[model samples]
Target: MTSLQVKDLDSGYGRIQILSGVSLEAKAGAVTCVFGPNGCGKSTLLRAIAGAVDTWSGSVRLGDQDLTGLPSHRVLQHGVTLMPQGGGVFPGLSTKENLLMGVYLLHDRAQRRHAVEQQLENFPRLRERLSTKAGQLSGGEQMMLSIARSLMLNPKFILFDEPSAGLSPKLVSEALQRVSTLAKQGVGVLMVEQNIQQALQVADYIHILANGTNRFSGTPAEIPSQKDFMQLYLGVKDSFNQDKELHHG
Candidate 1:
């Protein structure tokens, strides 16, 4: 089943069009990574989907709900969550309090409690630092908290913008692992990522965006095979097939 869909999405800042006729879909229980160079409107598209920006024209559907032009909170009500590029957290609050705030939309106290317990099970490190102030946590811990907190709502789809930004190699691996696990648990993940290799390693499908439009989209195997796109978008000098043939022979 399709978890989220965007059609002919045209949006941008006032008087400046950043995305023109952008369209894509995130399938249920799959990881779709949108890869692109800088200034390619990657973050802009994410903002448009999350309802942080008004769409000039288009339709955003989460399941059957039309999320176009809805406020961020209302979008969340549709079971779609976005964790923007930066780690969004309350600096003054304890880690546990920050996680609790993520469940604000849940009106049932019992359900919220159950979700919190489940979250601790999913992210044990968070449980260990439950009483620590969010600001005091390391960058990786903050990133984990940011992702863990969002799970409190049990969202159907989550948008991740540069989830690997500002992290060590170990943390990057951990972040990607968590995202992969989320997809396995039936949460659709649409990620805007700069780490092409790592993203491709975990992604079920990949979309390459350039000049505010979708340049190409396919499985990871199709990416490094397209020489022109490799040189143009990702700047790969040689195709993966050539390397594979040499190693095999």
Candidate 2:
């Protein structure tokens, strides 16, 4: 089982940098989570690893393979996949059709069919919605479909961006549970999620970002308390806000 590793990564859009010497490790059979204030570059870290964003410096590695600077498709070819924000499902496609599309790269008809059937077995909730359009499914259902589809490629690692974003609290719990299940099944999961408590419960390792760099990294139990984290990050934000207000005044 290979682990996804990012070492001193620096990347951003255009001339602006969102990550600065950021590094972390996501291991197979574990869920590694990135938590940060908005604009702190949690998503950029995942994008950088997947080669969806350019790495201005540093390295991305999966075992001995150097993945730095590889294009997104090439990254996928190497057994790493990403589930974009909000599941990235084709709203117009049927649930089954969307799952089938996940393995479109496999030219063998039998292989593709077998892959879809395997996902159906793992995600029985999707079995009932095979004929429904993806957009018509509930938020939780769509997330399940996305997870099932990603596994079709048999990726060693998967990146998730805001898996619980649009779901209700109950749905969010269910979705996070599903993420944990993926880890139990031996898939390395790196996720960006806003549901702090839920993520803390399920994540094997937690990394918190601030100003495009890691502010904290540890197991949930290592924290003094969630309140301490809130104060640490929010306090920085509050100081910045006061300075801004003073300048405006």
Candidate 3:
């Protein structure tokens, strides 16, 4: 089943068009990775769907609800959460405090407390850092905190923008594993990433964007098997140019 869908989406800042006629869909219990080089509009597509930027055209729907042009908070309330690239945790707050903040929408204090316990159970590292300030944690720990905070919403669909950014190789592996766990638990995930190799490894489907538009998209196995995959985003031309210059020298 399709958990999220965007059709003919055109969005950008002011008059600058970043995504033109872009379309994609994420299935329930699956991870769809959007891979691209810098300036390819990967992050813009995510912001547009998250309602951070206004959609100039096309439609976005989460499950059966139409989300086009909705406010970010309203869209969030509809069970579509966008987790952008960064350590979104509050540095000044204690680890437990940050997790509790995630459930502020839940008015009942008792419920929020229970939710904190549940989050701790899911993130053992968080349990150890409950009293520590978020700023004191390592990059991987911060990333885990950000993810655990999002899960507090118990969302139906999540848009993750480079969740593996600024992490060690081992952390990247763990982060991707966590994403896979989210998928298996039936949460729909759409991830935008620059960690192409690792992202492709976890992705059920891969969408490659170039110069503000989708250039190629297919299952990981299908696209990586072709030259276009590397040429499209990996700067194959630059590599070849460097090699040629060296050979001539």
Candidate 4:
């Protein structure tokens, strides 16, 4: 099975370290979610895997291919694509044009046409709005187009950064459902999300990060039983103080 693996990853901007010793695996046909409070290095981890940010130490690999320190474009060539947060779409371009841009790497004219057709078929809503500018679409439709654009490359692994950000509750559910569908279609999905309940609904495995390190990792069924799960969601300081009081009592 194709999988994205990160081992002992350490990375940050300039002199600051954001992620330390981070490790996880996102396997094909499964959704692996990284959940954490803001600034906990969840997004940094995804960026490191996508080659947008440099890794100071450790390694990233896809199946047998070592991807550490590769350029973002090279990572995409190796079947890894990143769909950034807040609908990374060209607002002025027609929906069809945006989708076509994803196939820029495909040299075969026929293949590119076929890929676009497939995406339109998979997202019929997009077909109806092919001529509409991406900015004119609703939040849900814009997000759908973003995801469709990424699929045009036929990537083996996809990294999603805050996919559900800045959407209504209903839209959040719909967006996450689409992500779940990708896993069913045999794509390895690694996502960093703040929507805990919705993320858990689709995740095959969950890893929670806190203070630039892994706090907890387990299946959905196992998460609730973890003592730190609530604490991780709440503030760590409150949980620690509560624990201290109980222990001293």
For model 1, what is the alpha-carbon lDDT of residue 212?
81
Q: Please write out the lDDT profile of model 1 over residues 1-249, one tens digit for every residue.
A: 756888889988989998988778788799999887898899999889988999899899988889999998998888888897767889899998999889988889898889889889978988999999999999888998999888888889999999999889888988998899999999999999888878888998776666787666667766444465465364243423322211100
Which candidate model has the greater TM-score, 2 or 3? Answer: 2
The C-alpha lDDT values of all candidates are: 0.83, 0.85, 0.82, 0.86
Cα lDDT for residue 227, candidate 4: 60
lDDT digits (tens) for residues 1-249 of candidate 4: 888888889999999999998878788989999888889898889889999999999999999999999998899999999999886999999998999889888899999899989999999999999999999999999999999998998999999998999899999999999999999989999999988878888999877777887665656675444465768554476442222211100
Candidate 1 root-mean-square deviation in Å:
5.6
Instruction: Write down the worst ten-residue block by lDDT for model 3.
Output: 240-249
Ranking by lDDT: 4, 2, 1, 3
Per-residue lDDT of 205 in model 1? 79
Superposed Cα deviation of residue 171, candidate 2 (Å)? 0.7
Instruction: Report, for all candidates in order, the number of backbone clashes.
Output: 0, 0, 0, 0
User: Per-residue alpha-carbon lDDT of model 2 for 128-185, expressed as tens digits?
Assistant: 9999999999888998999899899899999999999888999999999999998998
lDDT per residue for candidate 3 within 1-249, as digits (tens), equals: 656888889999988999988878788799989887888898899889989999999999986899999998888888888887885788999999999877877899888888888888998989999999999999988998999998887888889999988889999999998998999999999998888778777888767776676565567765434465767565454321212211100
TM-score of 3: 0.90
C-alpha lDDT of residue 153 in model 2: 85
- Misplaced by over 4 Å in model 1 are 224-226, 232-249
**Candidate 3 vs candidate 4, TM-score winner:** 4
Task: Give stretches of model 3 more than 4 Å off.
Answer: 224-226, 234-249
Worst 10 residues of 4 by lDDT: 240-249
TM-score ranking from best to worst? 4, 2, 3, 1
Clashing pairs in 3: none
